[model samples]
Target: MRSLFKTVLDQTKPVVDEGPRPDDKEAGIVSDDKEAANVSSERPPSSDGDDDSINKDAQPGVQKMEAITKVWSTRDLYLAYFLIWLIYFVDAIQQGMGTILTPYVTSAFQEHSLTATIGVASGIIGGISKLPLAKLIDIWGRPQGYLLTMCCMILGLVLMAASNNVNTYAAAQIFYWVGYNGISYTTTVFIADTSALRNRGLVLAYTSSPYIVTVWITGPLAQSVLNGVGWRWGFGIFAIVTPIVCLPLYFLFAWNERKAVKQGVLVRQKSTRTAWQSINHYFWEFDIICVLLLSAGFTLFLLPFSIFSVQKYGWRDPTTISLIVVGFVLLVFSAFWEKYWAPVKFLPWELLKDRTVCGACVLAAVLFIEYYIWTSYFTSFLQVVLRLEVWQTSYIANIYSIGSCLFSIPVGLAIRHTGRFKWVALYFGVPVTILAIGLLIQFRHEGTNIGWIIFVEIIYAFAGGACVICDQVAIMAAASHQEVAVVIAIEGLFSSIGGGIGGTVAGAIWTGVFPQKLKEYLPAETQDQWATIYGDLTAQISYPVGSATHAAIVAAYDDALRNMFIAATTITIVALVAVTFWRDIKLKDFKQVKGNVI
Candidate 1:
């Protein structure tokens, strides 16, 4: 299967270097002077350098600087890793807060229906932001991109803290989601830039280790804040702390950029064109139209899931039908534009022609889809079905993260030592994940043993950790340095799309099926209370342990979760199939791979 995809990609698009080849002295640098001149001419008008220097000396100087900049000392690499880890740590805390905020939103705003709607919106915004953000990172440099994301995060957090209505909160999430996705995508690019392929997997895995502390602490901390100060303070405190903690990283990046310049390892270009020309350049460069089309298409397409669920007529509603149809049309147009019409392509069709990159993306998307299907309802299952307390449910939920954190470093080190990732995906990740999901389906019934649930989660987490690291390493190993960031971003885009779709599918299933099942299971006398029971998740769990109503609700939840788990298990099997097509590319230090450095 893997060979088949490779053959097709090779025939469809010849695998040629998009940038300078290793043998070229200017390899890994920007395009040649003629190409650069053409690019500059097409840019929005900006201040330009001397024509004579650009014609004679500038290109050569730029080439020289690129070559010098490619060389990094051990200490420099360590500092870069430290910065990535630090940023990831802060991100984990923010994400943890987000996990708890759904319930808080439900309680504070008394809008239980908006919970899934907000998630879909966030996914849509985040997914759409990646395309332009990735290009901006490549064009503007990583530091500037990282700082921009931080600024957005701070702004969003402030808005969230101040928000008094659902509209304000949703608006804040749009900003925060974009910032979160941007920062994450930028960090991956940074790691790819700094780390050699041989150790890249390990570095990426280590970056996730902060989840160990953050995942555990985030729940309790958010709960405590909600119980004591208020949910508003939960957002306010992070708004204040994030900037302070992130300032050092801003300095670190600035320092690195300056050092590169001072060492003659970076050539800074001065724009000499008009402001309008500069604006035009950025528009074309970032491919804004494509971004808008894709974003609008996805947002419109996926939003109907949550919207229809909340609406009176559900999927039969005219608005829902129109959204789905129009969204599909827009997506088709965007694909057409990107493939055949766009001046600049956001999807990286060239690199994706590689079998490993394509396969890894497929696998990642499928896995994420599988993950979200079950995860979308995991907390509800624990609280409503098994009747666990918030702390207990949180502890159970953290098992996945904890398992992944514990095994990620070891899995990465193994890949680093062995230089083989495909077998890991094939032999360990696929099988373990399948087995875990299978067990989850079998055991996820009302009154199932808590121990069994924990066991399945642990196994699932470990396999997930291994698969994530392996997929990243495979993709990065297959790509050139110039393509690394975009490739990762593209992979993230796929995952986001998968997540959005998964959320929709899962939401439809739960909203459509769960209430019906509850009605069927509950006594006729209790049918009158369906609205009350379904509307308040807290109220569902608050029923007395031995009460008949509580038992009936628990049974309904178990049945609903069983169906979701079955869907998840089915989706996971596709990931296993995807793994079969993943090629095991030999990992090498990027510095040692000729023409591969940036």
Candidate 2:
């Protein structure tokens, strides 16, 4: 029966009516089956008229998308990164100047505690603000939130630029802090939205390169501007330039959002409840115990550092007890909130169960302390030890920033190809920590040159850049793809806390211990005279004073800063050992959404 059916099918097949074509006749071409099948499956090729209509209707979207994709891939997306970094660079200068000008600010304002308290407040504010904003990104959309943030930034900078009193300046810092925190958090979310997991590690690294670039630029730029123009002008120029540079990018991003929606690459949503619910659901569905343990581990680690400066007895003091108590409360709450309190927890509890997340956070917090000290004291280090003029000191400081900007892109790209950021963390972070510590030891000798400072900076900056990339990659690897934004936000939240603590602790070392060390290094009569002379440097440096005691005090201040770096390095070593225990997270591409989330 089968053979008979096949035979009938062959006979019934339409024969080719080869008219005058001898080639078609000789080939015995069957016209019916193959030609009909092809015609049925594929649309006919477009005519000229059809092509024109399609092009006319789709041209704007296609062109815009092409531009957006190009920008998204490497252009405008990075533009956001660059702008944020630039903002941070100028802000870093302002903040660094605040540190360098600490004595100046105290003298000018007639209050030392004022500057210290303000600095502490800024740190705390920057950290606390990120938590809510991270959650908001899913609801308000990144672009809109970012626009609000930039506007706040401009207002804050303007306030700072115009302020004449310490009270006014402090208020300006509040505004600046608000803007800075909001913009930073949203920009991270924007990066997560645009890049997939496969390329995200490198892309995020590229996006973050600007931070290193800005750190290099801001310090020297502020010093030169302060020396040549004035401190007021330093703030003024950034206030003017930041908006002009950042505004255009902000508008361009808005246009990109519209393009994304039109292209159907982005879905417009009226409610973000579902996304929130998604996160909360994951928490209940996963390991609640692990969340609490991880939170407790980090809180324990962070509490000692954060309050070390503000407490009366330092880390070993009785005050540490009170801070630990508060930290424990917060730690317990964080676990409970994430695991059970929310209708759905935003953080994936399973990722916290993995040793990678816990280890990365540990290393990241440690690596961040290095940056905190570097930014806080580069000016003091140069001006005091080298006895260089403000401009000369600031000029040397640029080497670190330059190293970071130059290396961020290549390092980020390299990590994408290697898929082994854990090793990058070790290679960059461990050595840099050692080099930083070594510089401190060298500073103990009176013979160390300013060139050593510059060289150490270059090494430290490269290490800092690589460490940042590794932490980011590690965070992504630990979390499921859908939780990428939350993961980044959480990491950032922890980093901000780390930076705050590092800066405060460094400040405590300088303010609390340095004066004692200075006395130990010099005789009492000379110390009293040196202290008196140091108090009036602004007036003395303005005149032609050939005082040798002035130089010694400067040297002592340099020694104090060197000690801070050494302490920072010790913290980094702890981070290094912790990272060694980190388990590698093997990430699948975003397209493979089939896997169980975390």
All models: lDDT? 0.70, 0.54
Model 1 per-residue lDDT at 136: 75
Report the lDDT tens digits of candidate 2 across residue range 432-540: 7567666765654444776776777788777766776677767666553235556666676567667766766666666555555556655454766534433333532
For all candidates, what are the clash counts? 16, 5
Give all candidate RMSDs, comma-separated.
9.5, 16.1
lDDT of 2 at 451: 71
Q: Give the TM-score of candidate 1.
A: 0.86
For model 2, the stretches where C-alpha displacement exceeds 4 angstroms are: 1-107, 110-118, 162-171, 196-198, 201-205, 208-224, 227-229, 259-350, 518-548, 551-555, 586-598
Please list all clashing residue pairs in model 2, or write none if there are none. Answer: 71-76, 216-401, 279-345, 280-344, 280-345
Candidate 1 Cα misplacement greater than 4 A, ranges: 1-76, 524-526, 589-598
